[model samples]
Target: MTDYVSTTPGLFPLPDWAKDDLSDLKGHQKHDLISGDEGEEITAAYEQARADVLEVQREADLDRVVEGQLRWDDMLAHPLAVHDAVETRGIVRYYDNNNFYREPVVTGDLEFDGDVAAELETVSELIDDDDDLQAVLPGPYSLFDLATDEHYGDDEEFLAAVGDFLAGELEAFPDHETLFLLEPSLVTDSPAEGLDELASEAIDTVAAATDADVVVQSYWGALEEKVHAHLLDADIDAVGYDFVSNQEDNLYNINEYGTADDISLGLVDGQNTLVEDPEAVRDRTDWVFDQLPVAEFDTVYLTTNTETFYLPYNKFEEKLAVLAEAASLAEVTPA
Candidate 1:
């Protein structure tokens, strides 16, 4: 009903194929393609790895593919570039790599190395090649979640700075770079009140910065009205929802995501190891359509919640097949 993009569930790190400069490299590291390298061979090696990643993705049975976010370490890792513009203090350490069910709090100001802007051109090009592809940016709040608050007095100031930086990158993606995708997972991870405030600053900033339809995602599983109200009010083009693992306990508010102008319903379980039942997911989609206007369903999208898939490369294709089959059975249009 919504925009069509099948997933092997959660986003897997991108394959080399999606990257430009990496050449023919394959596997997970393929996702990290930077412009400059140690030398021609290193660059060449990166390129080789890059090309293989793309091939795997291209051959992948997915719709509205995400280029594997092969470039990102997870949304939290994105705003690290802010280190350049704002000098912050804090040693970043994860309590757990598998940590996601709850909010991952940052006790200090996270450093910034704003150098990531340099890769915008590559991101844009990849997204452009696949219009159905969704792009990602760190939510200002997530940056807040991770930033070490040293130079910045408090979270608010840190957010303000991150929001400003995010706005330019989001705007640049489609024009100076690629089509676009903005995933704000932080809102779903915390109380809607505080996260909403951060969402407002970040969303409005990017919304004003670009005309590309913004698709704000809440993969943190906080499927409550409060989590999404700000996005709706922000006038963002769409909001994404995930029912992959735990469907939010509250159903009344769930309708907002589907009924709201443009929403991507994440039925494919992107994070779990269990392969989803396409038919079952379709049934859920059916129920969703009852509450939302079937005619307006074009605004909806179907995908896995997030990309930090922990699986190794070999198993992705089969997982991808499951995702593709689910989408096909659900009868969602393929991208």
Candidate 2:
């Protein structure tokens, strides 16, 4: 029998209470060095949000629970956007969605500042089981595609630098069972000519840094044939496909070139507020398993096609319930 696990890709919506608290504290916000009252309050607000979201994941019986990236206000670029060496430029559309994030312009060599690792540390303290906790971060290729490079004029150099920087950051990450490397750009914007290998190499750099299982999760749409082949060539554990957007193309790619023993299935539609029924989700997952070239998988994750920050908090909570119930339903029958 195959193991089915339900998990989220992180970047959850801020709760209304946290939003209110942050709004009131933004006026009196202070820099990192200064420990002002407002800064303390802001930190408290985020901490509370993390705790609440963790509780939600626990209640839903998700196999892996994330902190929901409550502090990632700038979305995928939050780390680089706040880095000292990188400059936050004007806003850019995030994929084809209505959401937007500040474009990060690399003005110097990338360096690890422990932003994401610190988050893991905080969230790890709240989770009782280390194996149940998962950390999420932006992938190397996506960072290169989304950001502007002014220091390293060469594409290869910048990508390598970003990967090295992330490796350093991962070195400081807290203990966790899994790492979800978000690489939506791999689907939204394919790698440049001759850079696919380099992209996979960069991915290997960061993936090798952690002992946790690494999953290169792509979203928005299915990857191109060549891109899919190169991604499978990476030294990662599993590849997550966006079935909600282009299930047929994703399935075709899997049947053509095949996939890893373990895989992640994005069964929930994150962009839509409508929650899917558990029975339908179970049927779709079974159909996917039947379509696979092989009968058995080591592990199969049921996740959202993309970040659920676009949905209302209530809708997001409902989707989480759906995933947990769907995983239960899928696991009831042997593959």
Candidate 3:
């Protein structure tokens, strides 16, 4: 039997109470106006929202629980944008989706500000056991791609700086179970030359800072050969493929190059509105394992292909149910 772990990439949709609290305080657009007593109320609302989301994950019997990132106003770039050296520029479309994030502009030397670390600490206190929580952050390469650099003139220098900053941030986080480095830009904007070595070096710098297991997850599409090889060689524990969006190419790459002993199979379709049947999902997982070489992987993480922010709250919960059901089914089947 395969050890089944279920988790999400962690930008959950804001619950109605959270939205209502923000609106009642001043309006979501004028978030800066929220302060004093109103600010405390808003904070309480976010806490309640986190508790609600965690309860859902716990009730679903998920192995890992995320903080839900309810306060990430600018999506993955929020943590970086909050840094003193970084400033927000014009809004840009986040990948191919309708969602947009304020593009971060690096105005001065990059440094690890405490935004993400502080959030991780707060989340740590909320959970009963540290091992049950998983911390999520945007990958350095993806951060560089999303931001406009003004301090570092050279691209290589800028990339290295971002990696160092991320390393510092990770080092600040309390001992937790896992760290997910989300890297959608790697697939959307594949590097031109020497990508394998460059990406591996950058990823290693950050992964080394944390004692917890590290998983670099790339979504949006399948990874190119050079990129895939680089990630496989990285110091991370596992690499997650966007099986829902690019199943054919991802499967082909897995068959051709093989994968790490630990693999994250994104079986749920987070982007689509349609929910998949649990039995069909089970069959697909079985099919993937059958195609792989013997002893290819020891653990399989059943998860969504992308963040749950794309779905409605109800649909998101429904999808979680599907993942939980599929994971239970996988546990009973022979590997």
Candidate 4:
């Protein structure tokens, strides 16, 4: 029998208590207040929110759980944006989404300040088994693309620096089963001539820092041939494709390249309010297998195409159920 595991791309929507806490703190004060007694209160709120989201995932029967990234104000850029080496510039649009993030300007040599590792440490105590938990971090190339580089003049030099910084962060994280290196920028920006090779190298740098299996997940659209080929060559365990956002193109890419590694299919539309029919999702999964060379992978992860923070809390919960049910419908064999 094929074992089925369900997971999310992390960054869940803030719960009511977290929202209330944010409301009380207000504006720039939220960041300022986090260092004092108020910071303790806010920390308590985040912990509660994390616990609540974990309970929801457990109740939904998801095989793995994330810390919900309740404090990631800047989405994928939060970890780097909050670092001392980086400064927040003006607000900028976060890709195609309606949301925004404070642009991170690298003013000095980048260094891992242990913020993400500390956050993971807090969440690690809550989990019964480390194997059932997944940790998430923005991919190095995506971070380099998202930020403004002042310290390193050359693009390749800047990319390598960012990769080293991320590797340090990953090294600090508690042992867990998987690390998801979210790489939406690779898809959004497409592959440039030398960029794909640089990205693969940076990914290898970060992936080597941890014992956990690393999954480099690209969303927002399907990866083009060059980018897909580079990702396959990267030292990562699996590649995730966003089938919901770019179904036909992703299917075509998979058929053309034929993945040799494990695959994660993002079937549920995390950005949309519409809940998908499980039967339709099952059929889609079957079609994906048909396009593969061997019609099998070491593991198949059924997940959301992107972060579910776009959806209303109720809709997000419904989507998780849809993913779990769809995974149950998939045919699997032991690795």
lDDT of each: 0.52, 0.87, 0.82, 0.83
TM-score per prediction, in order, is 0.71, 0.95, 0.94, 0.94
Tell me the lDDT of model 1 at 77.
51
**Model 1 spans > 4 angstroms off:** 1-3, 7-11, 14-46, 71-75, 81-120, 123-130, 174-195, 248-250, 256-259, 290-295, 329-335
- Give the candidates in order of lDDT, highest first: 2, 4, 3, 1
Q: What TM-score should be assigned to candidate 3?
A: 0.94
User: Per-residue alpha-carbon lDDT of model 3 for 32-90, expressed as tens digits?
Assistant: 53221236666778778888898888887788888888888788887777778877879
lDDT of 4 by residue, 102-189 (tens): 8999999887688888888877898789998899999998898889998899889999998999999989999789888999999998
Off by over 4 Å in 3: 24-38
- The positional error of residue 245 in candidate 1, measured at the CA in angstroms, is 3.0
How many backbone clashes does every candidate have?
45, 0, 0, 1
Model 2 accuracy (lDDT, Cα): 0.87
Per the 3 Å backbone cut-off, how many clashing residue pairs does candidate 4 have? 1
Q: Give lDDT tens digits, candidate 2, residues 144-199.
A: 88899999999999999999988899999989999999999988888977788788
Best by lDDT: 2
lDDT of 1 by residue, 1-335 (tens): 34444632234554424343343433324334332223554445444454555456567666644434443443455455323333323334432345332223333444343344444444446543545444556556666555455556765666776677667655445443112333434433463457566666666776677655566666646545665555566756656666664464323455444445655666765556666666766677776656543435554455666654565555555556655666676664432
